[model samples]
Target: MRPLVYEQTRFSPRVIFDAGNGVFEMEGTLMLEDNKVFFQTINRWWRIYQQSPNPQTKIVCKLNYYTLATDNFLMQWLYVLKDIPNVELIWYYNPDDWEMQEYATTYQSNYSFVKLKEEKVR
Candidate 1:
């Protein structure tokens, strides 16, 4: 299947699921006028990704503002990741947002954090 790319609008978000790169990045805003339309697209991408999928997927959520409804949507998003054992999520939040600390904790175990370095390995 071809990679899925949805451009951003003022009230909505950008959806990109690149199977080749093994990266799925979601950024920008989150304000869905129709909840059905919103969840349908996301859920389809995830469900399709699960079939004959890439071995590893890195998901990023760099939202500027996530509303309560979006939070619920996020739960479904995470559920998609949970099904794929190899899926890795990197949830980024500004350090000043103390409330996000609990979220990070819930996403990872205390032992999950380790020093990371960037380099191409053979």
Candidate 2:
């Protein structure tokens, strides 16, 4: 499947979903007023990728901030990964950001495939 990439914008996050390399990552802030249009392509791509997924798929998420809509979409997105074998979902949060840490914890608890990591400073 072809990759889906989106550059970060003021109201959206940067997304890179490369099925060829099995690297799916999203970062930056997501505060869009409406996420349906933005996520539609991702949803479609994911559906196609699910048909013939890689042996191992790794999804990394590193966000500074995100809206409730984005949060909901994330949960839904993760749910789709549940049925895929050998899928790993990693959520990275800054060490000082308690809210992000808690959010990661929540996701980890809800999804067995989720793994949380404190972001390392460069």
Candidate 3:
């Protein structure tokens, strides 16, 4: 399957879903006004990816900030990954940000199937 890449916008994040490499990553901020349109496109692509997923899938989420709209979309996306057997999810955050850490913890608790790992960065 061909990779799906969405360039980052002022109000959105950069999304890279590489089926070939089994590396799926989303980085930067995500607070788009047109969140539904953007996230649905990703949902469609993920459905297709689910059909013939790579042996090991690594998903990295490195968001500087995100609005609730993005979190709404992410819950859906995480559920999709929650069902996948060979998925590893890593959420990176600044070590100094307690809010981000709490958010990650809450998300990880809610989605127990994801095996979420919180990575602290500088």
Candidate 4:
């Protein structure tokens, strides 16, 4: 499958979904006013990838900020990932950002497949 790579923008995050390498990652902030279209593409890509997933898939999320719509989409995405085997989600948050930490905690609490980690200062 072709990879989905979107560069980070002022209103959206950087998304890299490479099914061949089993590297699915998203980083940066997401504050788009109309996120439906953006998320729709991701949902479609995910559905296709689900048909022939890799042996081990790791989804890395490093979001500093996001709107409620993005959060809801992420939660739904996690729900779908839950049923898949050998899939893990690593949520990385800034240690200094309490809100991000809280979000990570929420994901960890609800999803056993989610692993929370502090983003290393660069």
Candidate 5:
């Protein structure tokens, strides 16, 4: 499948799908004004992913510092990965953020891919 390229805006997060590499990477400041439009893009790709479920799918949540409003709504995206039947998810976080470890159970879905490492938050 030719990957889907969802452009990024000042308020919108960047989403890039790599069908060949088996990677679906999304990175940017999370502060979208329109929830419907923002979530629709995610939901559409998720539907595609559901149909063409890869053996391994890396969902990168590399956010520098999302606002509290964004954090609250972030659960919507997380729920998308909650119980992916066969796809392995990668929820990589900066080890420096103490908040990551505190909320371990929040990401029980394919937990193995959830790695806390020392990396620059793109």
Candidate 6:
């Protein structure tokens, strides 16, 4: 399968899931009007990646902000990552952004299978 690339909009994040290089990155803000549709694309890409995954898969989440509506979909996506072997999630948040930090903590509590590390950014 080809790599999945979704450009970001004013209310959505950018997605770059490159299966060949084993680098999956989601950046910018996430506040989509139709989250189900957006998340479904991510779900499909993830399923395909699991077929023949890289020895070490890295997911970088650099979301600056997100709406409340996005929590469920984000949780579900993280849950799916739990089943994939050798997956690590790096959640980057602004040093002063407690909300994002809290979200990362929640993810850590829910998905123990995938290694999660938090990074403070500018």
- Candidate 2: residue 69 lDDT (0-100): 64
Overlapping backbone residue pairs in candidate 1 total 0
Number of clashes recorded per candidate: 0, 0, 0, 0, 0, 0
Cα lDDT, all candidates: 0.65, 0.83, 0.79, 0.85, 0.62, 0.83
Q: Name the 10 consecutive residues with the lowest summed lDDT in model 4.
A: 113-122
Clashing pairs in 2: none
With candidate 6 superimposed using the best TM-score fit, by how many Å does residue 24's alpha carbon deviate from the native? 1.0
Kindly indicate the candidate among 2 and 4 with the higher lDDT. Answer: 4
lDDT of 1 by residue, 31-102 (tens): 777756787777887888788777666677666555666666666666666777566776666555554444
Which segments of model 1 are wrong by more than 4 Å? 99-122
Per-residue lDDT of candidate 4, residues 1-122 (tens digit): 99999999988899999988778999888999878788888888888888888989899988888876778887777777887678898899888988778878998999999999898522
lDDT tens per residue, model 3, 18-41: 988776988888888887898888
Q: Which residue segments of model 2 deviate by more than 4 Å?
A: 120-122
Q: What is the lDDT of residue 45 in candidate 2?
A: 82
Please, what are the lDDT tens digits per residue for candidate 6 over residues 1-122?
Answer: 69999898888788899988766899888887899999998998898888888998888888889988999999989877887898888877776778887887888888875444555542
Backbone-clash count (model 3)? 0
Q: Return the TM-score for candidate 4, rounded to 2 decimals.
A: 0.91
Mind sharing the TM-score for model 3?
0.87
Error of 4 at 9 (Å): 0.5
lDDT of 3 at 111: 76
lDDT of 6 at 54: 90
lDDT of 5 by residue, 31-120 (tens): 766666666677666767777677766666666555556654556666676556655545555566656434433554325545544466
Model 2 / residue 65 / CA error / Å: 0.8
Cα deviation at 50, candidate 2, in Å, is: 0.8
